[model samples]
Target chain A: TQLLEQSPQFLSIQEGENLTVYCNSSSVFSSLQWYRQEPGEGPVLLVTVVTGGEVKKLKRLTFQFGDARKDSSLHITAAQPGDTGLYLCAGASEAAGNKLTFGGGTRVLVKP
Target chain B: EPEVTQTPSHQVTQMGQEVILRCVPISNHLYFYWYRQILGQKVEFLVSFYNNEISEKSEIFDDQFSVERPDGSNFTLKIRSTKLEDSAMYFCASSRDSGLQAFFGQGTRLTVV
Candidate 1:
């Protein structure tokens, strides 16, 4: 089984602060996706990183796929109160039969 | 914008009772998936359906669990006998294909009493 280890299970930051969440795995993946979810709701897809060493920016949120495709990271800059939510990373590998192994998730709270 | 829709936003069932969760994926999407998340836990993939059949399933999807695309637009997950551990938020999702981003429904909170 391909296990994903996430960092800093919980994070509390003041508004305008910056933070990063990491998703690491030893197995290579065809694609990696980042999602954000609020309480009592399903996850909403934030971004999908496919190619190695690729970086995509969605306004204040930046996502990067590692050079080996075994890892990814999400960076939020100048975080705002609206950024508070549970962030998740999912890796999809062909060997895993197109299955998604989600990380434990990071709970972020942006205090204003 | 279109989103996946699930029925019975919340369900409470007695232990050992059968239950079926329903979903209507985005109108044009082709691949369908069922996932569950225990409170405060990560989303777990249950099964994936396409072409009127199942394409993949997780270890959690055992014999007691089955998926059916009943018709042209709806996909359902049937649990023959729900256990207490089955209490969780069940989410239905769909993507144009594996290569696309999957959109998820609001989810059905299943509380087994």
Candidate 2:
């Protein structure tokens, strides 16, 4: 079984504060996706990193895939109240039939 | 922007009753999946469907759970004899190919009493 453990299960930061969430696993994955889900809604894809050591930016969010493909991170610069949501990292392994293994989400609360 | 759509935003059923959750994936998507997020828990993969058959399933997908693509456009999940543990937010998603970006529906909140 593949598992992705996310750190800082909950984060409370003031507006303009920087935050980073990490997702790590023991198994290598073919791709890693970052999603943000608001209350009572489905997750929205923020970014997908397919190549090892790849980094993608979306506005103020920066997503990076580890060189070994076994870890990933999401960094938020100058977080705002609008950024508050559940941040999730999902890993997809081809050997696992393209099934996604999601990490425990990081519930971020950016207080304005 | 095309998106996955689900029917019945919320469903309330009693334990031991049956329930069917429906979804319409993106028109061009070939891979479909069902995932559930139990209150306060991580999103868990229930099953993955491709080529008109189940490609993968987790332990949570037991005999009581089944999936079907009754038509070319609609995919459904049926839970026979629902349990309280089944109460969760069920999300339907689809991707053009394996390991690709998946578009998700708003989700159906199932409440089994």
Best model per lDDT: 2
Encode model 1's per-residue lDDT on B1-113: one tens digit a residue. 99999998999999999999999999999889999999878888888887888888898999999988888888898998899999999999999867358888999999999
| Per-model RMSD to reference | 1.0, 0.9
DockQ of each: 0.69, 0.84
What TM-score would every model get versus the actual structure? 0.97, 0.97
Candidate 2 residues A1-112, lDDT tens each? 8999999899999999999999999999999999989888899988889999999999999999999999999999999999999999999999988888999999999999
Interface Cα RMSD, each model: 1.3, 0.7
Question: How do the residues A1-112 of candidate 1 rate in per-residue lDDT, one tens digit apiece?
Answer: 8888788799999999999999999999999999999899988999988899999999999999999999999999999999999999998877776767789999999999
Worst 10 residues of 1 chain A by lDDT: A92-101
Q: In candidate 2, what are the lDDT values of residues B3-74, reduced to their tens digit?
A: 999988999999999999999999999999999999888899999999999999999999999999999999
Give all candidates' CA lDDT scores: 0.91, 0.95
- Tell me the lDDT of model 2 at A103: 94
